[model samples]
Target: MFQSDFLRKFRILLVLVRRDYALQYAGSALGLTWMFLQNLSLVLIYTIVFYFLGIRTQGEDPLAYFAYVLSGLLFWVPLQEYLIRGTGILTDNRQLIKRSPLGPEIFLWIPFIQFLLHWAITAVPILAFLLWAGKLGGIGLPISFLCVFCTGLFVACLQSYLARINIILRDISPLVRLMTQFLFWGLPILYESKGILGKLNLLNPLFYPLETFRSFLLSGYESKAAFTDFLPFLILFLAIFFLSRARLNQIVLDHL
Candidate 1:
């Protein structure tokens, strides 16, 4: 019974994701093709500036640098979707939430569902490039995806807390956007990783997964240090998730 119920909801989730995707591109001329083109264009801009203008990170190899930037985008794009768009999930769907049989907490999964879609879209070219460059190892790709899944769990909890706060504060949306911008720039993608910012990655949780992704993509390997980083980050993520969850009562959520 439980398995059937879960499958039924999962089916509904897929339908909503399709509807949302269609609605987003409703008025566009190219429609779905723009999704592919948009990412390609963004990749080109970064590649041209950093790879062509004599600026480089990770290495001087064109393929490696491009792969490096693309790898960073893999983690960053979904995160932007999770935090920036997810911050507004409750407020934006308040009407549906109030009327729907399902609770608002069910809607929190929308951002995460979208994250999986966005991550897949971004992963294609990275996989292609790594394969073309002769860098993709069997385990590396799967492990990288596992890292993404692990980190994404925290995004849900963080989004839930932030969305709740946004209901009362109203400024969290913009604050989240602004802070996300800072977080991207602070990442070592644009600048070389040996700088002060790279050393400061111990505090930046995403850095662990990003670095792990890059390492596996580049060297086809992961280190013990990668495992070490994930342990502490996992602990921190679990603490935040439990603490935030305690506040997400159904009564308060419905009232909000």
Candidate 2:
């Protein structure tokens, strides 16, 4: 019974994932092919432009610099999706959510599904390049994936509240999008950290994990972070997740 139930839920989840992905490129003629290339094209644009600039994050090796930009965009794009799309999720699907009692819980997985798809579509080439560049090895690759998985959970927990907050405030959606633009510059992806901003990088909750993962992937050592760097963020986010989850249920039931 349990196995059957799990399988049923799994199939439903897959269908939802497919539907959402399709909706994203609904009017496009090529559809899935174009959907697959969109994220890769963005990464390629950044990689080519930066690699051509003669800026060297990994000594003078151009390939390593390519890997650097590739890895940054590979992760950063989905995070932007989570913040922007996730905040408006409730409002976007008010029709479905209002009909199904379990709506919010299920819809919460949509952003995560999109992340997995984006990663999966690019995973082969990304892993191959990392391998060819000697940036990943046996357990190292799995560890990198672990970092990505943890990040998925972090964003889901975060949006648990952000989604609810937007339903109430409405302005938060635009604000999140605007701030995300600033955050991209803030993250140490495009340039090396320097001076006051570099010092303040430690305080940004997203900074440590991303920096640690980047350093670990490139050089196999974490120069920018310790475990405790993101611990407080995790703790606070979990607390907010639980409280917000309860309140969200209340708001949906009582108001929406």
Candidate 3:
């Protein structure tokens, strides 16, 4: 049954992904090129301002800061995309959920897979940038790839659980958007974790995955250390995933 459900969900996800990819370039003059342009512009603006302000590390190379910031941004984009799309998934497909034979939970996977596809596509430029900056060496490659995959899984689960909750409580959706907006600054994306934690002691759990990811990828830090640091997050992610799956059907039925 699980296998059958998985195959069904995979087919639905593929259709959604195709639609999303088309929609992304439907009316755009530059088509899919806009994706690279958007990311490049943001990276350039961030690198220039941070460099001038001397916000980067003194000991590290100049490009190190750019690599660090880019790594975090890469991890962040899929996470943000899932959150934004997942929250609205149910409402947007209320007709299908109410009438179709497919499980509502399948809809949750749509946004998750869509974000994963976008993340894979975005990785091309990120790889080029890393190679150009001469940081793509040794342990960085494997650890960074692993960290990205793990972090993506965690975010997918987090967004799926949150989507169920948001459908029941409409206000929760906007609150999530506000929280993610605040988190862009609060999560140490553009700055070093040490500096952020030094200023604020009680760090949120949501930020740890990205911190661990950046450390492994840009800082060439040990994966075991980063994984151990986020053990609590892994535990929390599992608990949420199981609990959400267990109750998702009932939750969707009740909301309907």
Alpha-carbon TM-score of each model against the true structure:
0.86, 0.87, 0.80
Ranking by TM-score: 2, 1, 3
Q: What is the lDDT of residue 148 in candidate 1?
A: 83
lDDT of 1 by residue, 1-256 (tens): 9999999888877776676667678999998788778777876777677667646544477666666666777778777877887888778777777788877677778778888777888788767876887767666678777778867885676677787777666558879999888778767666556657666765666677677666765554343235675578667767766776686555446556
Candidate 1 Cα RMSD (Å): 2.7
Worst 10 residues of 3 by lDDT: 219-228
Enumerate clash totals for all models, in the order shown. Answer: 0, 0, 0
In the range 38-108, model 3's lDDT, one tens digit per residue, is: 76776677766755555656766557776777777778876776788777787767777888777677777
Model 2, which residues run further than 4 Å from truth?
A: 1-4, 55-59
Quality of model 1 by C-alpha lDDT: 0.71
- Pick the TM-score winner: 2
The CA lDDT of each predicted structure is 0.71, 0.73, 0.70
TM-score of 2: 0.87
All candidates in order of lDDT, best leading: 2, 1, 3
